[model samples]
Target: MATHVLIIGGGIAGLNAAKSLGDAAGITVTIVDRQNHHLFQPLLYQVAMAGLSPADIAAPIRSILSGFSNIHVLQGEARSIKLDCACVEFDFGVLHYDYLVIACGATHSYFGHAEWEEFAPGLKTVAQATEIRRRVLAAFEQAERIEEPDEQKKYLTFVIVGGGPTGVELAGAIGEMSRYTLARDFRRINPRLTRVILVEAGPRILPMFSEEQAGRAARDLEKLGVQIWTSSIVTNVDANGVEMGDERIQTATALWAAGTEASEIGRSNGMPVDGRGRVIVEPDLSIADHSNVFVAGDQACFTHQTDRPLQGTAPVALQQGRFIGKTIVQELSGKPRTQFQFFDKGQMATIGRSRAIVEIGRFKFAGWFAWVTWLIVHIYYLTGFKNRFFVVLQWAWSYMTFRRGARLIVEKEWRMNQLESEEMLVDTTDDMPR
Candidate 1:
């Protein structure tokens, strides 16, 4: 029998694993994902801000790996893994495998308040991004029509619940849009008066970064007119506004960039998950007691020699996925397994057009120079040269011209309702056969 390898989830880790293990070795690889396309999650915020299109950031899974004759891609949601049978079960059918890799990524954790998701949605996928974009753009339009000052204040203000990279980047982008991009577009409301509020439960923003860098980044954002509210936790979130401890801050838009938890698959399977729902993996990235089933990316967790738990970053996911690929290949060839060694690639976050902060080891930089470095690093890491070129050009044009043409709202709620009703009618007719 041929050695069949089953890979779950087609995100960065799963796709990279498939690419790394493309069938020159005498093994057959099958990748399964719920979605047909692979999304560039890192650039999801750009899509929300109309900096890039969905097509620019997403690629068909089959197109990327169609050249590999030994690899097959299936669009299916994984139901469960039968460890005793050495088989993986999906909604479609069972696939027996000698080895299995689970790269199922994390999802937005509502922190026990799942209802808050409707008000303060996080950007994880393409649908969520476009939905948020609609809400944001709609707020401006709605505010313009309202006559009440109180309602107008709510519309012109935006509250970001987390001060992490996503929150900071979004706040900065929206600030730029209000101050420069759409400054003169609105007649009634002064776009310059638009408030971008960033609320952090922690004492400082960007807790992952060094204190100096974090402090500087916060300062830069404040200079750009962002209201930084640190050490404040959101007690309640509603359509109108969010309650912060004892204070009630009103805003039309509330963005969640707070926390993430592993997929329901991990929780349902009774795997050893952390407090945040990340599966705990052994040194070789395999789940304990289930050596055949491995986990990586944001879905898996490992501690370094210094007892520092690995953070869910892109580099960590990529490295772990590639390591798992090599380890699987070694096992098939009857070679000894190797431990996963992670290399920290530093961190960068841009605030505005000419403002950013970058930390590379002991060296640190901020301001325009850091911003340039940040842009270069992001453009370099983004998949495909075409995307990189267009993204760079887009940012350059926006920086120089202060115009973003992707502001048109594509998906309206009314249109969606109409389509749903039409589909329902078709279903009813098909069932009746009239």
Candidate 2:
């Protein structure tokens, strides 16, 4: 009989891993996750800004893995693990495995200040994106109804706390959504009156990018009416607004894109983790002292020759996942195992319709050409062809007409237990702190 392999989490890492292993005849796979839908998280900001619907970027996990009869997708959460017995504990019961691959990915880190979540919600899932959309639209609605200048000021301002790619993308999208998309749509309020504030605790935005590229991105976003604050730390965040050092700004929406850490599967299973809560793994992407157990994607923190931990991005995660699958297959087939290597792909971000910055090897490009490249690259990375077509058409229309189509507010109602608080709807199934 083939060895039973159970994978946890249905993100890119887990899904790709299953695909790699499913092609081999000696593996029987079972995937367990809390949500049945698989979300393309890179474009979540587009959804929040009403550029794309939730269904456009999200798909049923079952549909993606339906081709493999040996693979099963379970829509539930894993509770715990019995390492000694090689079994996983879940809400549905227990699942035994010969080899376990944990690619549960990361969660937003509140920097030990969980209270800040009430004001500054992070965009990591479809639900969070939808909630942010509601809040953003609600701010405009509330502003339209109010006649007070002070109250209107509060409603028209937005603060984003972070300087990373997610922060930059969101800040730029929000600015466009307000100034261009909804400028002529509102009767009583001008969404163009919205002020976008981006605060970075670091010296510059996009520190990972080349200094010139980062500076160019900042300049483009500034031209779009986004206020950039560098070397500033947010001391507090509440429903009213965000407080940075001694300066306090009143705004209706504050977004958190500062930091993220690995899911608790590593720490809970007695694996080594770093200060940021990422699992420490070997060069081959296997957790220390446990060859049968592997970690990949945003969850694993393996250092390079320079001792720099790999960045948490889709490319890195997908490569690491495929490597793990190949290595496991080799071991199962009595073949040699090879060390994992990451191929460096260039990075790019779009500021607006015709403004972007891209870094590819020695060639760095900015402006309209790079913006077109950015759009193409994002569409290519999308999961399905249907999604690619939909996003492309949406972008084409937005670029030509200067209008966003998905601005309709959808307030979805659902029930939660008394013990469960609904603000952002925390997915604590994997919150096993070490």
Residue-level lDDT tens digits of model 2 in 19-65: 88875787899988899988888889888878889988888989988
Error of 1 at 418 (Å): 3.1
The lowest-lDDT stretch of 10 consecutive residues in candidate 2 is: 416-425
C-alpha root-mean-square deviation, each candidate: 2.6, 6.2
RMSD of 1: 2.6
Off by over 4 Å in 1: 412-434
- The CA-based lDDT of model 1 is what? 0.87
